[model samples]
Target: MQVLFITGQNQYGVVSHFLDGMREDLESVGVRTDSLSVESEQHIHRDLPQLLPLQEYDQLISFNGMGLHLEQAELSVPQYLKQRPVWVFCVDHPMHILKRIIGLNVILLCVDEEHVSFAQLCGFNARLFPHAIGKQQLANTSMMPLEDKSNEVVFPVSYMDSGSHRQALTPYWSQIGHWVEQSRSVTRFMQFIGVLPIGNRPASLTLNEQILRLCVTVDSYLRAKQREACLHFFAQQNVNLTVIGRNSHCYQSIAPTHQYLNAMDFTDLQQKIAAARYVVHNSPGFERGLHERVIYPLALGTLVLTFETPYVNQTFPQVCLDAKQSSGQISDKEYQQRRKQAHQQIEQQHCWHHQLRKLFTSPTTSPDSNGRTR
Candidate 1:
């Protein structure tokens, strides 16, 4: 099958990672897969989108709702549905009113069985496509080996606003300060692995192309800024925050309460996590509490504590501890046990490559699948 997958290009978080992996898996399995979005030309992207009318294409798949543009693509929801080939949406939040309001007939790349059932009740065709990861990055990573279990923590930041003048994390920073001062619970959690800093080499564009280039929409940029506030909130905590790569300006701008450090290389990251007491993930208080810092920390066998939100329950129930319920009260021995349990989960079900294979393989024709067809 010829499949065209469209999603936004900005590497703000995990969407690019998952969507790109899907295309790679489909191609390896001998299906023709094309991955496209506003940032399709970037190095991270394997497939590309073009200006030609998608109506001429064999199949079109929107990643959530990637290709729908007001003027540039000249494709509206009505036109999109009327010419629909195979429309599949990948969304993890609670049921959206749009499924009922717009009256769409598209299938969904749902997160779980509950999500599928809920979508069905709301009057849409949905299917469970469990959360997964891609294998390509597995080969690319330096693959850090575990360190001697120490009381360290990892605090990762998302993107930030360079244009804005005000510091965003003021309210939450005081709380983190209080926790750091009062909580001996995470003595080992004191060592933090902060975010990967952006190397920020803007992609080149020609004059006509410059005008044609799609900048991040205002709403998307605001969302990124909001994530910055989430990260900054943890700045004054007692832990030692070691940054992975060149992080955003919000982190770079502020003086850290905890000492700051940088990685010598990617392998060093593994050593840092293995040694840390626990992982303190920064999650924005938003409609859905989504943060990647939580998931990767667990997969690496670190004990994770994050903001309580619906997304965590939907995306990563088996691997993570509910941060809201956790008082940060566990002993060092208890912490180690949590780490041991977490790594076991990763080995069994959360390896990125393993999940990628599961996601891209379309619903099989096997009779064991009860002869169900999409």
Candidate 2:
């Protein structure tokens, strides 16, 4: 089989690493694959269809429905690819996914179950296919030694918004944003509302319900505060920590004890995670998806210390924390065990090769009238 892989450019170039890994995995399985990287929506609208002839490939795999205007635009790519199957690997919010390709003849592969349900609600074909560790890192047959690791702790996070970004959003939600950020009770309440299971919920919602739904859809304020809270907590501890990402200026001010690093490609970041004694991730306030940060480190045999959530706690019960704790709270023995179990879990269920195999072979690909694929 032949495949066309699409990914976008990010500031850190992490998406490139993921695309490279996917291409390698497909080739290993005897599939002819090619990749395209786009920087903006104009790049996708103008350049994607022309990247290759649709008849030359049997499948198209798009990473993150970024830069797509399928619903509104009269596009050639979507029309041409309708003759074949198109699979999207989306990590963004559910609403963004729904907005981009609701009416297209595409198979939606979502990173989170909530996204799958929300897409189904909008009458689009969707399935829950979570993100997995890339083939490059997973190819390592042996785990690295603990002593060889350089950093004691490593974390990669981006500040939710900059000053100008806040100014742009403030006009619409200044008061509501303040309430959600300042009040812990309000944030928790909103988070609970945000975590409501998507499939069985009422079809028609009241105005208040719609507002809460909007919170789930657009959760930048809560994410920013959550990252701030995690940084503050880490700063309070005496552990040696290294943070890498854009918007370090915002976090560096609060976490004086932690060492800040510059934005980098995922290849180097994965190396850091493998070498670190512990990979730290604090839960984002209202976000329900398992981010690449969490999955990558686990695949590399790093112990992750993050807050307890239904998704994390239920899916990987061995890795969840009892309370909001820093790296110092964990012991050496505990770290060893968690790291071992994390690696085992990744190899068993969360590898990219396994997900791809399922994508092609699973009979659970049929979409219902309501857009659900059971």
Candidate 3:
């Protein structure tokens, strides 16, 4: 099989790393792969035609719908893309890219189960494709003894302050809060937003579209709040905390006592994880999915302290530390056992090769179905 990856610029430059890893893994399995780098929307119109006048590959894969948004006037581009199956691997919430992907003949491979449900609700074909640890990440990491690790806690995430989002979204907070309280899950919140009349809907968007946009905004705000809360909780305990990512200065106000460093590429981030005693993962919106952040640290022999989510509790109950609980209570022997179990599980089930096999072999689901593969 042959696959063409639609690559593009991302803020943190992690997407390129992911594509490179996937390419290596796919080739190892006898799948030929190519990539097209799109710098902007204009590049898509200009460069995509190069693939036209002939069918070249079995599949066209993109992350977060990067190069698939073809304009209606660009008949050739859309026609060319439609000839081959298009797959979008959504690493974040699907709602954020709903507008860009509306008319494309693309199947969504979501990292989270809730994301699949959200995409299906929006009338798209989606499947549950959980995040996995790349082979390169594993190859670069060496398990450090817990006592020998340098940092006590490391959080490698891009920071977004919730206060700004909260103030901007204040007008719709009461209604959004009410909907959130009634419907605890993101999928259900979207259902309510679709049917209920939102008086504060934006003038530019249709009712459903406007409400859905609000839901995305609200989700972002909540996620930011949750991250901030987690950071503050750790700082209050006076643990040796280190924050690494963009907007490191934001930590000054949020948690001044903690050490902060600007963002680095995925390669450097792996080094940081391999040295840390514990990695804190704050996944606020992903209730039924595991983030690569959670998996990478565990695979690197660093215990993960994250919020209690259904997927984490069920999959890595031995390794995950509930953000609400004290990590100091766990004995050294227990920690070693948990780390061993977590590493084995990731090696056995959550590696890139495992995901690639599932991606190629699994049957696609109907758009009307429940959007789950496992």
Candidate 4:
């Protein structure tokens, strides 16, 4: 089998590192693989086919359909790569015309079940393909002894332009249908009956589009707020915490007690993670699906201290930590046990090879009846 992968230039360059493992794993199984990095949406629609000669490739697997310009690809790619399997691994919800573009030749693999349901509702083939840890990470890490590891807990912060977002959102918040502005308890009651407010919906959005935007915005705000609160909670206890990312002011409320560090390349960051006693991960807020943060630490056998949510609670009950507690609460032996369990589970069930096997072997219909989703 031969495969061509198209992926976005993700923030901080972690996607590139993950794909390296994928290439190695596929090659080890006697399958040839190649990849293309889409730097911008423009590159996807115009330069993709020219850069990636699909003639020799049996399959085209794309990661993050949002970046692939799927609508454009739907129109152009078929002209050149006719009948070739085109699999889009969607990491985010399909909110655009891309949902309407998935046809018999195009298969949707989504990280979020909500996306799968949406695609299926639209009468398109979709499957749940959650994020996974790359095996290469384990190979590259040189784990430090528990005693020698840093006591300081490190967190990678997501950058946000709060001022601009707030300015844009304020008016829309006020314009929400008055029925939504009831008391907090009443609002909750209304939500039970499916009467939630369309918070900060843009003027151009239709009702369905605004509702989708509202859901995404609400989740984004909840995550931003939860992250801030988590940082503040730790900082107040005078815990030795380090925040690593491009912007520190994003969580500036915890500035006095927290130290800031610039985000490093994935290779360098893995070394730091392996040497750290514990890496702190803030929940992506509420019931949102897992982020790469959880699996990345576990792959390297580093203890992760994250906010307890339903997904984490169900997935890694042994490794879950209460946000109120200090890092020292867990004994070194207990930490080691959790780390080992996490590593084993992720390697067995959530690694790239594990997922790819399911993708190819599923009895469900495959491209060309070859039993491969590509």
Specify the highest-TM-score model's number.
3
TM-score between model 3 and native: 0.83
Task: For residues 283-360, write the lDDT of model 2, one tens digit per residue.
Answer: 553235576777887777776766544576567777745335433456667767887887788778877777787766
Give residue 205's error in model 3 in angstroms: 13
User: Could you tell me how far off, in angstroms, the CA of residue 121 lies in candidate 4 after the best superposition?
Assistant: 4.7
RMSD values for the candidates in order, in angstroms, are: 13.3, 5.0, 5.1, 5.8
Residue-by-residue lDDT tens digits, candidate 3, 68-102: 75443433336655554478888888887777688
Give the alpha carbon lDDT tens digit for every residue of 101-194 in model 4: 4444567777655556556655557777777765665566555678888776778776554345445446566654342233222223224224
lDDT of each: 0.46, 0.63, 0.73, 0.62
Residue pairs with backbone atoms closer than 3 Å in model 4 (clashes) = none
Quick one: best lDDT, which candidate? 3
At residue 312, give the lDDT of candidate 4. Answer: 58
Ranking of candidates on lDDT, top first: 3, 2, 4, 1
User: After superposition, which runs of candidate 4 have C-alpha atoms over 4 Å from their true positions?
Assistant: 40-56, 66-76, 80-85, 96-105, 118-124, 161-163, 175-216, 285-288, 324-328, 365-374
Error of 4 at 53 (Å): 4.5
